[model samples]
Target chain A: MQNKMIGYVMILAMLLFGGLSTVQAADGAKATNPEAAKVEKMIADADKARKKAASVEGEWRDVGKMLKKAKAALAKGDYKTAKKLAAKAKSQGEMGYKQAVAQKDLKMPSYLKY
Target chain B: MKHLLKKIAMLAVAGGIAASAQASPEADREAFQNFYKNRFASVPMEEYPNGVYSIDPVGRENWEAIEEFPPYEPFIDEGQAMWEKPFANGKTYKDCFADGPAIAGIYPLWDKKNGMVITLPLALNKCREANGEKPLKYKKGSINDILSYIAYESRGQKTNVIIPKDDPRALAAYEKGKKFYYTRRGQLNFSCANCHLQNAGMNIRADRLGPALGHTTHFPVYRSKWGTVGTLHRRVTGCNKQVRAKPFKAQGEQYRNLEYFLTYMSNGLELNGPGARK
Candidate 1:
């Protein structure tokens, strides 16, 4: 009855708006300390890593490509492959992040370094 | 098909009642998806009844509860002992300030001579360092010296943070913080102002949004997630991770400046230090 109608409405709503966050990611982190020296170093390191990740020749086109594949798998309800690639990309990203934060004498969060 | 529809309706009603009674992360996520799609940035800025880490109704709260909290009573006792210990000229902790508790509001003020802002916590550390004792971190033992003494001193004093409106230096520091809040810098590409300033009541994953205003009133509260009491800097570090940004050092200039801005936002709120947080 009414309950069935509400369930249908709710699922449809999630499909319509599940992807968007409350705030747009495009204009995110405006309150971050840009002049933070440690953050600067880490950003530089991550940039280098991003470039390096993008330039791989044989198996990996880039983390971007992998992420796209991961995203596609996700859209297709393939959680297993999506989780694997996301984990892989995370490790590569973490490696570069480690070098950057370490070089600048900053304490790394466990997730980034370990 | 009609019978099936009736069955589905009955099941759905039962499920909704159950889900409402016992909400799970999955249920909350679905709620956020239904109610707040992408409004993850702005947070509510009103005074929350229970002072904990600022909550963004729109996002998932990372820290849940701290099983064990470090007892500040022992630390405060040590601070008291340190305060009672004599200084160079046989000066007692009482000699340090005419009225110790009356001093908390005057700190983190604009220092025109230094062209910077100084916090009372920093000032106390500076006094200790100048007199040859190691300065303590904001929530560490040395802070206990101030907090314990100031806790005694904190009686009847105002909890307002006063920054001169005309001072450009203060404004500069504030603007820096403002920029940090609005700019997207992390892997998740989220900002503090996004959750705290803009979307206070919007649901993120499971938790309700909270306002950033008056956020400073409940610092150094016992957190269940860390299993101990800590300061706002530690909480900020946790947030950096949520957004996938590299966290600046706790109590570093950035956090201090941000504290300055946050205190300014909570200017008129009374001091309720050592609060409790989830």
Candidate 2:
């Protein structure tokens, strides 16, 4: 009887600890989704880039809309879609800012006589 | 010897300043008109008020046919009725604009008191608010109605947008507008000059890009694509969007300044608003 009781105690401990470990692992995943975090960072960068472009009145129409869509994808845990969109938006923002900066001095077109 | 040196230095400085200073509005206008004159040697200066139709012979035939039974006629009639109708405050638009509806040529002017460009649509809205009436939407709706009537009546009045010499701000506004025109924006990275100025009379897909000259003479245009009469700002908004850039608000400082510059370009062109277009 003593041996049987010891065996049952060991099995019970294993089941309890195993179940607890599984729950902990799930909690860990929920708390620290590296992919989600990366996507959020990308979105933040895109927003900063967009604002920089807008500061010079160089913002493209779809950059804002793209950022919004990226955030929505991020909320839905669609990291791939979010990252792709955020990257495009950031690129567009940079392009627009560069475009405006390049024309800082009004270089009237060659065709247009001053 | 020192006095002579100082006078020479002062003369050099003055010459530099004169050279660096942007061409006056009049000079700019002359250059702008001359560009089109040289490009379309066959098309007369007076024919420009007809827009792209002046250059496109085939399109001009269709445009002439459309004009015979003018689509904008009802809008003009509606605008006339609105003009005649009294406001809620027992005042009509005439009360505010004593000069009356034929006053479209006078607009897109510098409002010295406001330190801003005041467009016709904005003036009309102010008139409405002053008379205790609801302001109309800028891009579309009944605003086009009243504007159609005003433009129709104002036909033949020359587009003479004066940037007052007294107010330096007026010239600054024109400069801002000129900058805006040349600046590239949007995903397409196209400036207003890319299509309208650089590629004027060139076909983009099926549509021939119209010349920037006389662009502002016809406003409140009835475009077949729109199927309704829309203001110049409305067309401007569409152009921005076409290039995939965000559009500025109608009558907003940016657009008003743009209108000021654009109208100034069309100076001496006959007012031919409430125009039909494809």
Candidate 3:
């Protein structure tokens, strides 16, 4: 009877672990290609932001290069690197735009003051 | 109550000063001229076209020596030849200018029709295009040579840029140019005035800075560093890069407007281009 109890406990433990492994497999699949659609949206948004900034003559250096590289990485299915570069490019472009706007009403230096 | 009144009085004074500081082209010219004169009491106004050499005795001596056998002489000769040379249409540069003496000083004009500043180089290119010849590059080589000759011929003509009040666009362009002159940009965050105006006659390492008062008087300067003649725009580009800013295209609208603003500031100064400089 004790041996029979031991067999039942083993069966229960196996069932619990087997269910957990299945969930783990699903999580592993999610991790390998996690949020690819979200990363693509981020890249698209960054590209638009950069273009808007450039139209007003507020382009900063390396933003274009970064974007291009990001797109290239995305094409190669390297979503992690692509998303990082795109985000950086977007930030740089936004800063450039802000700078151009601020310069429009720039204060003249005291020496330049009449 | 007394302190508050005092603050109000100070604010009024500040407002008055600010109102005066919105400089008109005419007012700016007068003020800039006075500022330079006051700063360099020893140097004669006419000698300002000599740039840094005017303020530095050692630099002047060296410049004078270079002038004795001016390295730019060959460029002038070459430019004169090109000027006289006929295009495929058998038309010459004289056809473009109507045989006018080199009018370098009267340029960067507000073209009311085109709604743009017509610089000497741009006009030259337009002339070339009309005659079915390819336009020359704006920065260096044969273009620089041609400008050097024109500037040499127009030497002593006073810089007299006009921003006609008839057109609102003209004023806007002038204001834009003025803003650009003062706006700090690039990684270094230096404006054109930082080196040329505020730090004028001061040295940054081995280089002595020139004043902005007569900045536009000379162009197509034969810089030893370049080992060739360079135009005012080229010098401006170099200055922009030195301040870590991305340079605009030579003869682009931004530069043309800047030229217009600077030339206006140098009203009454003589043109002495194709100059030699270190």
The complex in candidate 2 yields a DockQ of 0.41
Candidate 2 similarity to native, TM-score? 0.86
Cα lDDT tens digits, model 2, B1-278, are: 99999999999976654442367778778878888988899998899999999899999999999999999999999999999999987889999899888999898889899899999999999999988888999999999999999999999999889899899999999989987987888888899989887899999999899999888888899999999999999999998998988888888888989999988998899999899999
lDDT string, candidate 1, B65-118, tens digits: 331343444544565677677777666556666666446656557677776767
* Candidate 2: TM-score, chain B only: 0.92
Off by over 4 Å in 2: A1-34, B1-21
Runs in model 3 lying further than 4 Å from the true structure: A1-92, B1-14, B17-21, B99-101
Provide the TM-score for each candidate, comma-separated: 0.52, 0.86, 0.80
What tens-digit string does per-residue lDDT give for candidate 1 at A16-103? 7665521222112212323222332333444456555323210122445555565555443345675676656555565544433432
True contacts kept of each: 0.00, 0.82, 0.23
Candidate 3 CAPRI category: incorrect
Model 1 residue B174 lDDT score: 60
Better of 1 and 2 by DockQ: 2
**DockQ for all models:** 0.02, 0.41, 0.18
lDDT of 2 at A101: 82
The residue-level lDDT of candidate 1 at A5 comes to 57
Worst 10 residues of 2 chain B by lDDT: B13-22
Per lDDT, the best of the predicted structures is 2
TM-score, prediction 3: 0.80
